[model samples]
Target: MAIRVTSEHDLIIEGGGMKIIDGRFGQPLYPSSPSTNHIVLLPENFLVSGTEQRISRRDFLSVLANVTRVMVRASYSTEPSAVYRLHSFSMQVANPSARGERRASAVEMCSCPPGYAGTSCEACIPGFRRVNGNLYNGVCEACHCHGHATQCHEVTGHCLDCSHHTTGPHCDTCLPGYYGNATRGSPADCQPCTCPLNLPSNNFSPTCHLGEEGELLCDQCQPGYTGPRCDRCSNGYYGKPVVPGGSCQPCDCHGNLDLSIPGSCDPSTGQCLRCRQGYGGAACDSCADGYYGDAITAKNCQPCQCHTNGSVYEVCNKETGQCPCKENVVGRQCDECMPNCWWDAERQECMPCHCSPHGSISQRCDVEGRCICRPGFVGRRCDLRRQGYERRETRRPVERVPIDTVQQRWGGPSRTGGCPRGAYRPKTGPLTHGITTGGQCVPCHCNSFGSKSFDCDETGQCRCQPGVTGPKCDRCSRGFFNFQEGGCTPCQCSHVGNNCDANTGQCICPPNAIGERCDRCAPNHWGHDITTGCKECGCSVIGSVTQQCNVNTGCCLCRDSFRGEKCNECQIGYRDFPQCTQCECNVSGSDSETCDMERGVCACADRTGKCSCKANVEGHNCGLL
Candidate 1:
């Protein structure tokens, strides 16, 4: 056995030898150099007493020397010939202790390798990123273009654009009432299938067909119809064209028949077969005698011939036998009198008779008549008076007596005691023999002389004084003026008298002055007398005074200080005056004396001084002042 030493500089050692010459020196033994040969051993075969463990192939190759040779012997079992065998071999030594040990650093184990990940260098395929982590447990994710989804990339997920009826997330579903194609990246179009009009569409799916079992089915009359198919008419059929949808049937006889009677009219013929006897027409509006029907039927009644005894009621119609009569008569024939008349059933007469004299014949008769005669008349006919005849002697007049003696003869109060103050009596009868007279002594009227001896007629009618009239001489005669003493007097001018003619009031006003008391004047005249009482200057114009006339021009009389025939207006340059006396301006000094009428300015005595000017003018002498 040979032991060889290797040099650090030698990468591959063959037939290796070790001798301490230079750092790169080698020696052999026997067939090789002594030093080199001993260090570098090569032999056919060798046996040793020391125990040596077998080396593994991997360990032996690690320490094998370059160019080292060895020999091995094998026995042949053939008897043909004994063979001497020379076997050549090489020797390689390795350290078996190095087995099951690691040579890499801890940092290298912790770091990820290029294009790999995780502690074990396990990662996704190239060009792909881990979705979760750097181990086989992680998922490989891919990147995708905008708006497009990737099929192989889960980490980057999917990118997709919404299709026609689909949207959101994975684009997995359709919109309401819409359905899309099944596949992705396709057009994904949607279809809509709504039900027909007047029908209900069912389900949310958009691909539904019209007659599908679960879809909406529409068939039938809209409303107000019937029958198995909803197309027939109801009880009261109504429509047009006489079809199944024709209009409803109208009531028979319509408005012409009465609804109160169930069989009033025939439904098929629409005619009234028979009306109640009192009734007529389709509506049965006829009335019987003495009764009337309303608009509805003739059988319906109203009273007729409503008039009293003397009055007649006329029939309104013969068929209905209805009569509208006069207010005073009533009954079927108007034969009976109203309660106001006397009904005489015996004669069948209504009498106008009343109580006796003013009323009818019955003791309790209500009628009225005239009376026989008045109370004062006593003859059978109430025309003649009773007679009586007798004779009497006449008497002669007697002589007069002194009133004083007659007064004494009365022995009571004087006969004049009851007479008025001015009344008197005349003596005509004898006193010594006591007066004998055929006529009775008469009373007398009162006189102005205080005598009561004047005579009066048997009726006491007195003769009036010269100017008096009236039974009592209480009033004056016509044309007389005085009212006292009940006598007349001459009328005075310009004064009215009570006894004068009513048309003229007795005074008789003078010419130009006229009134009840001569207090007023006629037009164009003034004053109270023909001279002073009346000034008639013919001032015919209105607002004119007597002085303004040609006959009396006292001052060319002005009205409201306006002097003119017409009195049209005030004079020029003057205002507010009975006479044109207001000066145009105030005189300030002797220099300014009078106001100039034309210019309305003061005339100045000294031409140099200021002038008293009218309103609107100023300066010396008011020259343009």
Candidate 2:
């Protein structure tokens, strides 16, 4: 098959025919001749594909070694049909039109073809620009006009009548909220004005118009609305209205038509001019009933609150709410209670009627100042207890009784009952008419732990339980045992803690004196007694062999040389030695001076021996000195 590198040159179509050209001039490497008709143009260091023809690597390299440039037409293959077919697949050259309608010869030079451009008419036109801009075997792409127009200006790329919302010369840009044509035509030229999804359709205008202001204006404003976009309510009007129809409502101003000044009221605020007499409020419609002061201002009124419900009529004076009083009730506004009924400021009205001293409840009575007494009480003022009525016990009430006759009655056994439990009656004279000062039965506050019984003696002393000896029986009794929190537990002294102090819980210590209960004597001390502290056993190094001494009595352990109980004195055998003096005798001598322990001396057998006697010379037994 023949390969046309360009319209000017064709690659020779022959068996295993291969070639290369100098890419710098884009021409054949060797001059074309009849024997070698085809040409191949390649850039420096180009890769060659030989699978199409099965050319060996060695043959392809040999052809690429020498590259040249030329402009010539030659025929290399004698098989014309295959060459023509190959040209149809890869390239197409046009035949020049005959001037006189004569048929053109096949041998005539081929002309540049349609849809092709460039010097050799081998490159696809601009509308079908090459992919990758490569001149060798590069595919061509048809120009995209963005669907706005069939074609675009070849060089400037300016498109005509860009599609909706699309703009730009190449129709490649989209308008805001629109998918096409962003740079051409007016902002809304191809854009359909739409309402925001959040805005209600009923209140918003039906259609949108985008004008020179570059703003979208609804076709018509709803009634009661006035604005460039008709999105806001007009003055004196409120609420969102339907498009081109509904209007806002004007403030009724409380419907005070007579007092309100015409056209003087604020449409939006509903505030009117000066209010009429006996009227107040933003609309001047509030009746100044039971009010006082200026009725024209917003804070015009003050309450009247008639005294004692004495107002002649329900409505009070126009200027102030103060009302005139009736003769029965007093005070400027007749707000005070009558003489019998005291005014209760906190309760804001006449309080309970003032009854006499013996009133049952807190001075509460009928309109009159009479007393209200309990069931058993009777009198004009409930001051006297009924003759036949007996006293009844009751818890102390919050209010004090005017006169407590029951509490002052005789304390001794009454004809009825004596006294309540936990209480005692005071002693009285035998059937005496007069009651004693201490007549009331009183309760004794004795501690439960101490008192054996709830009753108390006439002197008010509680009887204590066993093992409880305090005046209140609150502590352990002397010699009692087991002391704890419930009362005083006695000491478990075990004979050693005898006669213990009940309050301190300390028992008399044992004779040996030591332990907490004084049961035993401590280690080094001894000879303890109830009256005396333990004595320390004295053990001196000089008197005793070891520090250990007798634990029973205050005595030093003695050594062999020591004889006294405390080891301070020596034994009789060693009377003269402070530690332990032993008797000494002179065997050689036969004087009468016997061995003397106290002096550690033995006289010589006779006075003639000088060492036997102390100083003077003596006779035979030291009898004569």
Per-residue accuracy of model 2 over 1-625 as CA lDDT, tens digit each? 2233343323322222344322222233322322222223223322333333344444544453332332234443343342422222232323444466655332323254554564434367645555555444445555565455544454444665666556566666654443223444444445543432223553444445556756765555554455655655544445444344433555454443342344444544555554545556766656566566654346455566664455566556665555776544566577655665654446555654544444343454332233445544543344445433554443755333334453443123332114443355656545445544446676655445455444555445556644666544555677664443223444556555357766565776745476776756776677766566577666655767655556665677678766566677654334443535453443234233444445454533222333343346444433444
Give the per-residue lDDT of model 1 (tens digit) for 1-625: 2333322221222222321111122221122223212223212111121222333322232223233543222332233433333233343443324564654332224355454443444454443456775233455554332222333233544434544555445545444444434234454343443311112322212232223443332233344233332333332223331233233233332233444555455433335544444444443444444455463432345555544443454544644543454444455555544544445556555554332221122222111111122222112122211111111222521222234443342224334324432233334454455533333343454332111123343344455544455545555556444433213343334242323442333555566767666666665554444334566654324335543444334223545435465343344334433334333334433133345445544433322334456556665434353
Weakest lDDT window of 10 consecutive positions for candidate 2: 84-93
Cα miss at 383, model 1 (Å)? 25
Best by TM-score: 2
Give all TM-scores, in the order shown: 0.17, 0.25
lDDT of every predicted structure (CA atoms):
0.38, 0.48
lDDT of 2 at 350: 62
RMSD of 2: 44.8
Count of clashing pairs, candidate 2: 39
Off by over 4 Å in 2: 1-442, 479-488, 499-512, 530-533, 539-541, 546-549, 553-555, 573-625
Provide the lDDT at 417 for model 2: 19
